[model samples]
Target chain A: MLISNMEIIPGKQIQKHFGLVQGSSVRAKHVGRDIMASLKNIFGGELKGYTELLQESRDEAMDRMQQQAHAIGANAILNVRFSTSSVAQGAAEIYVYGTAVILE
Target chain B: MIELTIFLVLMTLGYLVGQYAEKKHYQSIIEREKRLSGLTTVASRFPPPGKQHDQCLVLGSVVISVDYFKRFIAMLRNLFGGRITSYEALLDRARRESLLRMKEQAAKMGAEYVFNVKYETASISKGRQNTIGSVEVLAYGTALMRPRDEA
Candidate 1:
Protein backbone atom coordinates (compact mmCIF):
# COMPACT_ATOMS: atom_id res chain seq x y z
CA MET A 1 0.00 0.00 0.00
CA LEU A 2 2.91 2.36 0.77
CA ILE A 3 5.09 3.47 -2.16
CA SER A 4 8.28 5.52 -2.39
CA ASN A 5 10.95 5.75 -5.03
CA MET A 6 13.44 5.61 -2.22
CA GLU A 7 13.98 2.21 -0.60
CA ILE A 8 13.78 3.35 2.97
CA ILE A 9 10.63 4.59 4.65
CA PRO A 10 11.72 6.91 7.47
CA GLY A 11 9.71 5.51 10.38
CA LYS A 12 8.31 2.20 9.19
CA GLN A 13 10.33 -0.90 9.89
CA ILE A 14 10.77 -3.38 7.06
CA GLN A 15 9.97 -6.73 8.62
CA LYS A 16 10.41 -8.80 5.46
CA HIS A 17 11.36 -8.71 1.82
CA PHE A 18 8.53 -9.98 -0.37
CA GLY A 19 10.81 -10.48 -3.34
CA LEU A 20 9.54 -9.61 -6.86
CA VAL A 21 5.80 -8.95 -6.73
CA GLN A 22 4.17 -6.83 -9.42
CA GLY A 23 1.17 -5.61 -11.46
CA SER A 24 0.69 -3.89 -14.79
CA SER A 25 -1.84 -2.51 -17.26
CA VAL A 26 -2.07 -1.01 -20.74
CA ARG A 27 -3.45 2.53 -20.90
CA ALA A 28 -4.68 4.56 -23.88
CA LYS A 29 -5.94 8.01 -23.04
CA HIS A 30 -8.73 9.89 -24.84
CA VAL A 31 -8.04 13.09 -26.74
CA GLY A 32 -10.71 15.65 -25.97
CA ARG A 33 -8.99 18.85 -24.82
CA ASP A 34 -6.72 19.76 -27.71
CA ILE A 35 -8.59 22.96 -28.49
CA MET A 36 -8.38 24.22 -24.91
CA ALA A 37 -4.77 23.05 -24.57
CA SER A 38 -3.82 24.98 -27.68
CA LEU A 39 -5.38 28.08 -26.14
CA LYS A 40 -3.67 27.35 -22.84
CA ASN A 41 -0.42 27.06 -24.72
CA ILE A 42 -0.77 30.65 -25.89
CA PHE A 43 -1.63 31.83 -22.36
CA GLY A 44 1.27 29.75 -20.94
CA GLY A 45 0.78 27.70 -17.76
CA GLU A 46 0.58 24.19 -16.34
CA LEU A 47 -1.93 21.84 -17.97
CA LYS A 48 -4.16 20.32 -15.29
CA GLY A 49 -5.73 17.76 -17.61
CA TYR A 50 -2.50 15.92 -18.32
CA THR A 51 -1.56 16.06 -14.67
CA GLU A 52 -4.80 14.35 -13.74
CA LEU A 53 -4.30 11.74 -16.44
CA LEU A 54 -0.81 10.81 -15.28
CA GLN A 55 -1.94 10.70 -11.66
CA GLU A 56 -4.76 8.37 -12.53
CA SER A 57 -2.42 6.08 -14.44
CA ARG A 58 -0.14 5.98 -11.42
CA ASP A 59 -3.04 5.06 -9.18
CA GLU A 60 -4.29 2.31 -11.47
CA ALA A 61 -0.87 0.71 -11.73
CA MET A 62 -0.41 1.07 -7.98
CA ASP A 63 -3.78 -0.51 -7.34
CA ARG A 64 -2.90 -3.53 -9.45
CA MET A 65 0.50 -3.78 -7.77
CA GLN A 66 -1.12 -3.61 -4.34
CA GLN A 67 -3.52 -6.35 -5.24
CA GLN A 68 -0.56 -8.50 -6.10
CA ALA A 69 1.11 -7.57 -2.81
CA HIS A 70 -2.04 -8.30 -0.82
CA ALA A 71 -2.39 -11.67 -2.44
CA ILE A 72 1.08 -12.37 -1.11
CA GLY A 73 0.20 -10.89 2.30
CA ALA A 74 2.62 -8.02 2.13
CA ASN A 75 2.22 -4.73 3.97
CA ALA A 76 4.83 -2.81 2.04
CA ILE A 77 6.42 -2.67 -1.40
CA LEU A 78 10.03 -1.62 -1.59
CA ASN A 79 12.33 -0.48 -4.37
CA VAL A 80 9.33 0.23 -6.56
CA ARG A 81 9.95 1.19 -10.17
CA PHE A 82 8.09 1.97 -13.42
CA SER A 83 9.06 1.32 -17.03
CA THR A 84 7.37 2.40 -20.27
CA SER A 85 7.20 0.63 -23.63
CA SER A 86 5.36 1.84 -26.70
CA VAL A 87 2.71 -0.72 -27.59
CA ALA A 88 1.20 1.17 -30.48
CA GLN A 89 0.33 4.69 -31.61
CA GLY A 90 -1.63 5.72 -28.51
CA ALA A 91 -1.31 2.72 -26.22
CA ALA A 92 1.40 2.31 -23.57
CA GLU A 93 2.53 -0.29 -21.08
CA ILE A 94 2.24 0.67 -17.40
CA TYR A 95 4.08 -1.68 -15.09
CA VAL A 96 4.50 -1.45 -11.31
CA TYR A 97 6.94 -3.69 -9.52
CA GLY A 98 8.58 -4.07 -6.11
CA THR A 99 9.60 -6.53 -3.46
CA ALA A 100 6.56 -7.50 -1.43
CA VAL A 101 7.35 -7.76 2.25
CA ILE A 102 5.54 -7.56 5.55
CA LEU A 103 6.52 -4.70 7.82
CA GLU A 104 6.31 -4.72 11.60
CA MET B 1 -16.42 23.50 -52.08
CA ILE B 2 -15.77 26.53 -49.84
CA GLU B 3 -16.74 24.61 -46.70
CA LEU B 4 -14.52 21.68 -47.69
CA THR B 5 -11.60 23.97 -48.33
CA ILE B 6 -12.05 25.63 -44.92
CA PHE B 7 -12.19 22.26 -43.17
CA LEU B 8 -9.00 21.12 -44.85
CA VAL B 9 -7.33 24.38 -43.95
CA LEU B 10 -8.36 24.03 -40.32
CA MET B 11 -6.93 20.52 -40.19
CA THR B 12 -3.70 21.64 -41.78
CA LEU B 13 -3.32 24.57 -39.39
CA GLY B 14 -4.09 22.40 -36.38
CA TYR B 15 -1.56 19.82 -37.51
CA LEU B 16 1.13 22.42 -37.86
CA VAL B 17 0.36 23.88 -34.46
CA GLY B 18 0.49 20.44 -32.81
CA GLN B 19 3.90 19.72 -34.35
CA TYR B 20 5.25 23.03 -33.10
CA ALA B 21 4.06 22.35 -29.56
CA GLU B 22 5.62 18.90 -29.57
CA LYS B 23 9.00 20.23 -30.67
CA LYS B 24 8.93 22.95 -28.08
CA HIS B 25 8.36 20.44 -25.30
CA TYR B 26 11.47 18.46 -26.20
CA GLN B 27 13.52 21.61 -26.59
CA SER B 28 12.64 22.52 -23.02
CA ILE B 29 13.53 19.02 -21.82
CA ILE B 30 16.93 19.25 -23.46
CA GLU B 31 17.52 22.57 -21.74
CA ARG B 32 16.55 21.04 -18.37
CA GLU B 33 18.85 18.06 -18.94
CA LYS B 34 21.76 20.38 -19.49
CA ARG B 35 21.13 21.70 -16.02
CA LEU B 36 20.65 18.21 -14.50
CA SER B 37 23.47 16.33 -16.22
CA GLY B 38 25.70 15.75 -13.20
CA LEU B 39 23.13 16.05 -10.46
CA THR B 40 21.73 13.00 -8.59
CA THR B 41 20.02 11.84 -5.37
CA VAL B 42 21.06 9.54 -2.48
CA ALA B 43 18.96 8.16 0.39
CA SER B 44 18.57 5.42 3.06
CA ARG B 45 16.02 3.58 5.23
CA PHE B 46 18.38 2.51 7.99
CA PRO B 47 18.83 3.98 11.44
CA PRO B 48 22.01 5.77 12.56
CA PRO B 49 23.23 7.66 9.50
CA GLY B 50 26.94 6.75 9.64
CA LYS B 51 27.83 5.28 6.21
CA GLN B 52 24.42 3.89 5.27
CA HIS B 53 23.45 5.99 2.27
CA ASP B 54 23.12 3.87 -0.85
CA GLN B 55 24.23 4.96 -4.31
CA CYS B 56 22.85 4.49 -7.82
CA LEU B 57 24.12 5.32 -11.29
CA VAL B 58 22.23 8.01 -13.16
CA LEU B 59 22.25 6.54 -16.63
CA GLY B 60 21.97 9.55 -18.91
CA SER B 61 18.25 10.19 -19.29
CA VAL B 62 16.43 10.63 -22.59
CA VAL B 63 12.76 11.13 -23.36
CA ILE B 64 12.98 9.42 -26.74
CA SER B 65 9.82 9.64 -28.87
CA VAL B 66 8.45 10.45 -32.34
CA ASP B 67 5.45 12.44 -31.23
CA TYR B 68 7.18 15.74 -31.84
CA PHE B 69 7.27 15.05 -35.53
CA LYS B 70 4.06 13.06 -35.64
CA ARG B 71 1.86 15.62 -33.94
CA PHE B 72 1.39 17.47 -37.21
CA ILE B 73 0.08 14.42 -39.00
CA ALA B 74 -1.69 13.13 -35.92
CA MET B 75 -3.76 16.29 -36.14
CA LEU B 76 -4.77 15.63 -39.74
CA ARG B 77 -6.02 12.15 -38.83
CA ASN B 78 -8.71 11.73 -36.17
CA LEU B 79 -9.64 8.74 -33.93
CA PHE B 80 -6.10 7.76 -33.02
CA GLY B 81 -7.41 5.35 -30.37
CA GLY B 82 -4.51 4.10 -28.18
CA ARG B 83 -1.52 4.72 -30.33
CA ILE B 84 -0.07 8.12 -29.54
CA THR B 85 3.67 8.57 -28.93
CA SER B 86 3.67 11.99 -27.27
CA TYR B 87 3.58 10.45 -23.82
CA GLU B 88 6.74 8.40 -24.36
CA ALA B 89 9.20 11.21 -23.80
CA LEU B 90 7.23 12.58 -20.91
CA LEU B 91 7.15 9.16 -19.27
CA ASP B 92 10.84 8.68 -19.89
CA ARG B 93 11.63 12.00 -18.29
CA ALA B 94 9.48 11.23 -15.29
CA ARG B 95 11.20 7.89 -14.75
CA ARG B 96 14.64 9.37 -15.02
CA GLU B 97 13.75 12.27 -12.78
CA SER B 98 12.43 9.96 -10.10
CA LEU B 99 15.55 7.85 -10.28
CA LEU B 100 17.75 10.90 -10.05
CA ARG B 101 15.93 12.16 -6.99
CA MET B 102 16.04 8.72 -5.38
CA LYS B 103 19.78 8.56 -5.82
CA GLU B 104 20.17 11.97 -4.22
CA GLN B 105 18.02 10.99 -1.27
CA ALA B 106 19.86 7.71 -0.89
CA ALA B 107 23.23 9.43 -0.68
CA LYS B 108 21.93 11.97 1.84
CA MET B 109 20.68 9.17 4.07
CA GLY B 110 23.82 7.06 3.60
CA ALA B 111 22.03 3.81 2.86
CA GLU B 112 23.44 1.51 0.23
CA TYR B 113 21.35 -0.72 -2.05
CA VAL B 114 17.91 0.78 -2.51
CA PHE B 115 15.72 -2.22 -3.31
CA ASN B 116 12.15 -2.75 -4.53
CA VAL B 117 11.07 -0.18 -7.09
CA LYS B 118 7.85 0.86 -8.90
CA TYR B 119 6.51 3.42 -11.41
CA GLU B 120 3.13 4.83 -12.58
CA THR B 121 1.57 7.14 -15.21
CA ALA B 122 -1.53 9.30 -15.52
CA SER B 123 -3.15 11.77 -17.88
CA ILE B 124 -2.21 15.30 -16.97
CA SER B 125 -4.13 16.60 -19.96
CA LYS B 126 -6.52 15.33 -22.60
CA GLY B 127 -5.93 15.96 -26.29
CA ARG B 128 -8.73 17.81 -28.09
CA GLN B 129 -10.74 16.62 -31.08
CA ASN B 130 -8.18 18.17 -33.36
CA THR B 131 -5.37 16.13 -31.74
CA ILE B 132 -4.75 13.27 -29.27
CA GLY B 133 -4.41 12.74 -25.52
CA SER B 134 -1.42 13.60 -23.27
CA VAL B 135 -0.30 11.94 -20.06
CA GLU B 136 2.45 12.12 -17.42
CA VAL B 137 4.15 9.15 -15.83
CA LEU B 138 5.43 9.12 -12.24
CA ALA B 139 8.22 6.60 -11.82
CA TYR B 140 9.39 5.85 -8.28
CA GLY B 141 11.25 3.13 -6.39
CA THR B 142 12.99 2.33 -3.12
CA ALA B 143 16.39 4.01 -3.21
CA LEU B 144 18.28 0.98 -1.96
CA MET B 145 21.99 0.75 -2.56
CA ARG B 146 24.43 -2.06 -1.93
CA PRO B 147 26.86 -1.20 0.83
CA ARG B 148 30.41 -0.71 -0.31
CA ASP B 149 31.37 -3.57 1.96
CA GLU B 150 28.75 -5.76 0.30
CA ALA B 151 29.57 -4.58 -3.19
Candidate 2:
Protein backbone atom coordinates (compact mmCIF):
# COMPACT_ATOMS: atom_id res chain seq x y z
CA MET A 1 0.00 0.00 0.00
CA LEU A 2 1.21 3.51 -0.68
CA ILE A 3 1.80 5.65 2.40
CA SER A 4 2.74 9.26 2.71
CA ASN A 5 2.83 11.71 5.57
CA MET A 6 1.54 14.52 3.41
CA GLU A 7 -2.11 15.31 2.92
CA ILE A 8 -1.69 14.79 -0.83
CA ILE A 9 0.38 12.28 -2.73
CA PRO A 10 2.48 13.63 -5.57
CA GLY A 11 1.20 11.42 -8.37
CA LYS A 12 -1.84 9.80 -6.79
CA GLN A 13 -5.39 10.98 -6.25
CA ILE A 14 -7.34 10.46 -3.03
CA GLN A 15 -10.68 8.89 -3.83
CA LYS A 16 -11.87 8.44 -0.25
CA HIS A 17 -10.84 9.22 3.28
CA PHE A 18 -11.05 6.68 6.14
CA GLY A 19 -10.56 8.97 9.12
CA LEU A 20 -7.77 7.84 11.47
CA VAL A 21 -5.99 4.51 11.99
CA GLN A 22 -3.47 3.67 14.68
CA GLY A 23 -1.08 1.02 16.00
CA SER A 24 1.04 0.86 19.13
CA SER A 25 3.34 -1.46 21.04
CA VAL A 26 5.37 -1.48 24.24
CA ARG A 27 8.71 -3.25 24.53
CA ALA A 28 11.22 -3.87 27.29
CA LYS A 29 14.94 -4.35 27.08
CA HIS A 30 16.29 -7.83 27.51
CA VAL A 31 18.55 -8.53 30.44
CA GLY A 32 21.45 -9.39 28.17
CA ARG A 33 21.02 -6.27 26.10
CA ASP A 34 20.64 -4.17 29.20
CA ILE A 35 23.89 -5.51 30.52
CA MET A 36 25.64 -4.69 27.30
CA ALA A 37 24.11 -1.22 27.23
CA SER A 38 25.28 -0.49 30.74
CA LEU A 39 28.77 -1.49 29.77
CA LYS A 40 28.68 0.72 26.70
CA ASN A 41 27.27 3.65 28.68
CA ILE A 42 30.45 4.31 30.58
CA PHE A 43 32.43 5.54 27.60
CA GLY A 44 29.19 6.88 26.06
CA GLY A 45 28.33 6.54 22.37
CA GLU A 46 25.67 4.59 20.51
CA LEU A 47 23.86 1.74 22.21
CA LYS A 48 23.40 -0.87 19.49
CA GLY A 49 21.17 -3.18 21.49
CA TYR A 50 18.72 -0.47 22.50
CA THR A 51 18.68 0.91 18.96
CA GLU A 52 17.67 -2.49 17.66
CA LEU A 53 14.95 -2.82 20.27
CA LEU A 54 13.37 0.52 19.39
CA GLN A 55 13.63 -0.18 15.67
CA GLU A 56 11.86 -3.49 16.10
CA SER A 57 9.15 -1.89 18.18
CA ARG A 58 8.60 0.83 15.58
CA ASP A 59 8.46 -1.66 12.68
CA GLU A 60 5.95 -3.81 14.53
CA ALA A 61 3.82 -0.79 15.29
CA MET A 62 3.91 0.30 11.66
CA ASP A 63 3.00 -3.19 10.51
CA ARG A 64 -0.01 -3.26 12.80
CA MET A 65 -1.05 0.16 11.53
CA GLN A 66 -0.82 -1.07 7.97
CA GLN A 67 -2.97 -4.06 8.87
CA GLN A 68 -5.61 -1.76 10.29
CA ALA A 69 -5.54 0.35 7.17
CA HIS A 70 -5.95 -2.75 5.05
CA ALA A 71 -8.87 -3.98 7.14
CA ILE A 72 -10.71 -0.79 6.34
CA GLY A 73 -9.97 -1.37 2.62
CA ALA A 74 -7.56 1.50 2.34
CA ASN A 75 -5.07 1.43 -0.47
CA ALA A 76 -2.89 3.94 1.34
CA ILE A 77 -2.22 5.60 4.65
CA LEU A 78 -1.74 9.35 4.58
CA ASN A 79 -0.46 11.98 6.97
CA VAL A 80 1.24 9.30 9.05
CA ARG A 81 2.78 10.29 12.37
CA PHE A 82 4.75 8.60 15.14
CA SER A 83 5.12 9.01 18.93
CA THR A 84 7.29 7.30 21.50
CA SER A 85 7.46 7.29 25.27
CA SER A 86 9.34 5.48 27.94
CA VAL A 87 6.59 3.66 29.77
CA ALA A 88 8.92 2.31 32.44
CA GLN A 89 12.47 1.62 33.26
CA GLY A 90 14.09 -0.23 30.37
CA ALA A 91 10.84 -0.28 28.42
CA ALA A 92 9.44 1.96 25.71
CA GLU A 93 6.15 2.51 23.91
CA ILE A 94 5.93 3.31 20.21
CA TYR A 95 2.69 4.56 18.72
CA VAL A 96 1.89 5.43 15.11
CA TYR A 97 -1.22 6.89 13.58
CA GLY A 98 -2.37 8.06 10.16
CA THR A 99 -5.32 8.63 7.92
CA ALA A 100 -6.43 5.66 5.84
CA VAL A 101 -7.63 6.42 2.38
CA ILE A 102 -8.39 4.94 -1.01
CA LEU A 103 -6.08 6.18 -3.74
CA GLU A 104 -6.44 5.99 -7.46
CA MET B 1 40.03 1.66 50.45
CA ILE B 2 38.77 -1.38 48.57
CA GLU B 3 35.63 0.48 47.60
CA LEU B 4 37.70 3.25 46.10
CA THR B 5 39.73 0.73 44.16
CA ILE B 6 36.61 -0.92 42.77
CA PHE B 7 35.15 2.41 41.78
CA LEU B 8 38.32 3.38 40.05
CA VAL B 9 38.42 0.12 38.16
CA LEU B 10 34.82 0.42 37.02
CA MET B 11 35.30 4.03 35.99
CA THR B 12 38.43 3.15 34.04
CA LEU B 13 36.70 0.29 32.29
CA GLY B 14 33.77 2.49 31.42
CA TYR B 15 36.03 5.23 30.12
CA LEU B 16 38.14 2.98 27.93
CA VAL B 17 35.37 0.85 26.50
CA GLY B 18 32.90 3.69 26.14
CA GLN B 19 35.37 5.90 24.28
CA TYR B 20 36.33 3.10 21.92
CA ALA B 21 32.74 2.21 21.18
CA GLU B 22 31.73 5.85 20.69
CA LYS B 23 34.52 6.51 18.24
CA LYS B 24 33.61 3.44 16.25
CA HIS B 25 29.96 4.44 16.19
CA TYR B 26 30.74 7.96 14.97
CA GLN B 27 32.84 6.52 12.18
CA SER B 28 30.07 4.21 11.05
CA ILE B 29 27.41 6.92 11.24
CA ILE B 30 29.50 9.28 9.12
CA GLU B 31 30.15 6.62 6.52
CA ARG B 32 26.50 5.60 6.25
CA GLU B 33 25.32 9.20 6.13
CA LYS B 34 27.61 9.80 3.19
CA ARG B 35 26.42 6.71 1.40
CA LEU B 36 22.78 7.72 1.80
CA SER B 37 23.38 11.29 0.73
CA GLY B 38 21.58 10.66 -2.54
CA LEU B 39 18.33 10.06 -0.72
CA THR B 40 17.40 13.60 0.26
CA THR B 41 15.61 14.05 3.59
CA VAL B 42 13.79 17.19 4.55
CA ALA B 43 11.65 18.40 7.42
CA SER B 44 9.27 20.41 5.32
CA ARG B 45 5.68 19.27 5.29
CA PHE B 46 5.63 19.68 1.50
CA PRO B 47 7.20 17.26 -0.88
CA PRO B 48 10.38 18.07 -2.81
CA PRO B 49 10.16 19.34 -6.34
CA GLY B 50 10.50 16.36 -8.68
CA LYS B 51 8.53 14.10 -10.94
CA GLN B 52 6.87 11.97 -8.29
CA HIS B 53 6.04 8.35 -8.81
CA ASP B 54 5.03 6.17 -5.87
CA GLN B 55 5.08 7.13 -2.21
CA CYS B 56 5.16 5.27 1.11
CA LEU B 57 5.78 5.78 4.79
CA VAL B 58 9.16 5.03 6.28
CA LEU B 59 10.43 5.21 9.85
CA GLY B 60 13.54 4.73 11.96
CA SER B 61 13.62 4.59 15.72
CA VAL B 62 16.23 3.95 18.39
CA VAL B 63 16.46 3.62 22.17
CA ILE B 64 19.62 4.41 24.11
CA SER B 65 20.44 4.35 27.79
CA VAL B 66 23.00 6.18 29.84
CA ASP B 67 25.87 4.25 31.30
CA TYR B 68 26.40 4.15 35.02
CA PHE B 69 29.39 6.44 34.84
CA LYS B 70 27.68 9.08 32.72
CA ARG B 71 24.66 8.97 34.98
CA PHE B 72 26.86 9.50 37.97
CA ILE B 73 28.58 12.41 36.35
CA ALA B 74 25.27 13.93 35.33
CA MET B 75 23.98 13.58 38.85
CA LEU B 76 26.95 15.55 40.07
CA ARG B 77 26.48 18.14 37.35
CA ASN B 78 22.90 18.54 38.46
CA LEU B 79 24.13 19.86 41.73
CA PHE B 80 26.16 22.59 40.00
CA GLY B 81 23.56 23.37 37.33
CA GLY B 82 25.99 23.58 34.44
CA ARG B 83 25.98 21.85 31.05
CA ILE B 84 25.90 18.09 31.09
CA THR B 85 28.18 17.77 28.12
CA SER B 86 28.17 13.99 28.18
CA TYR B 87 24.43 13.59 27.94
CA GLU B 88 24.38 16.38 25.39
CA ALA B 89 26.59 14.42 23.02
CA LEU B 90 24.55 11.28 23.59
CA LEU B 91 21.31 12.97 22.61
CA ASP B 92 22.90 14.58 19.57
CA ARG B 93 24.16 11.24 18.39
CA ALA B 94 20.78 9.63 18.91
CA ARG B 95 18.98 12.29 16.88
CA ARG B 96 21.38 12.23 13.95
CA GLU B 97 21.63 8.46 13.96
CA SER B 98 17.89 8.03 13.92
CA LEU B 99 17.56 10.44 11.00
CA LEU B 100 20.24 8.59 9.10
CA ARG B 101 18.44 5.34 9.79
CA MET B 102 15.24 6.76 8.32
CA LYS B 103 17.08 7.77 5.17
CA GLU B 104 18.55 4.30 4.93
CA GLN B 105 15.08 2.82 5.12
CA ALA B 106 13.83 5.13 2.40
CA ALA B 107 16.76 4.22 0.17
CA LYS B 108 16.10 0.54 0.69
CA MET B 109 12.58 1.09 -0.62
CA GLY B 110 13.98 2.68 -3.80
CA ALA B 111 12.95 6.16 -2.81
CA GLU B 112 14.84 9.14 -4.11
CA TYR B 113 13.48 11.65 -1.63
CA VAL B 114 12.11 11.66 1.89
CA PHE B 115 9.99 14.60 2.87
CA ASN B 116 7.88 15.80 5.78
CA VAL B 117 10.25 14.20 8.24
CA LYS B 118 9.29 14.26 11.90
CA TYR B 119 10.91 13.33 15.18
CA GLU B 120 9.65 12.27 18.62
CA THR B 121 11.55 11.52 21.80
CA ALA B 122 10.64 10.03 25.15
CA SER B 123 12.49 9.60 28.38
CA ILE B 124 11.99 6.28 30.10
CA SER B 125 12.03 6.55 33.84
CA LYS B 126 12.56 3.79 36.33
CA GLY B 127 11.41 3.45 39.92
CA ARG B 128 12.34 6.44 42.08
CA GLN B 129 15.53 7.43 40.34
CA ASN B 130 15.14 10.98 39.04
CA THR B 131 17.96 10.37 36.62
CA ILE B 132 16.96 9.39 33.10
CA GLY B 133 17.91 5.81 32.37
CA SER B 134 17.10 5.59 28.71
CA VAL B 135 15.65 7.58 25.83
CA GLU B 136 13.83 6.68 22.62
CA VAL B 137 13.99 8.78 19.45
CA LEU B 138 11.85 8.09 16.38
CA ALA B 139 12.29 9.56 12.91
CA TYR B 140 9.77 9.09 10.14
CA GLY B 141 8.84 10.51 6.76
CA THR B 142 7.31 9.90 3.36
CA ALA B 143 9.53 8.29 0.75
CA LEU B 144 8.93 9.36 -2.83
CA MET B 145 9.74 6.82 -5.49
CA ARG B 146 10.27 8.05 -9.03
CA PRO B 147 9.43 6.15 -12.17
CA ARG B 148 12.23 3.98 -13.50
CA ASP B 149 11.90 5.65 -16.88
CA GLU B 150 12.68 9.05 -15.32
CA ALA B 151 16.25 7.88 -14.74
Q: Please tell me which predicted candidate would have the highest TM-score against the true structure.
A: 2
Measured on C-alpha atoms, candidate 2 has an lDDT of: 0.79
Q: Evaluated with DockQ, which candidate comes out highest?
A: 2
Q: lDDT of each structure?
A: 0.52, 0.79
Lowest-sum lDDT 10-residue window in model 1 chain B: B57-66
Candidate 2, chain A: TM-score against the reference: 0.96
Off by over 4 Å in 2: none
Please write out the lDDT profile of model 2 over residues A1-104, one tens digit for every residue: 87678888766678999999999999998899878876665555557787778778878998999999999999888888888776777788888899999988
Instruction: Assign candidate 1 its CAPRI class.
Output: incorrect
Candidate 1 chain A worst ten-residue window by lDDT: A37-46
lDDT of 2 by residue, B59-106 (tens): 787666666577778889999999998788678777888898889888
Q: Which candidate has the highest lDDT of all?
A: 2
lDDT of 2 at B122: 75
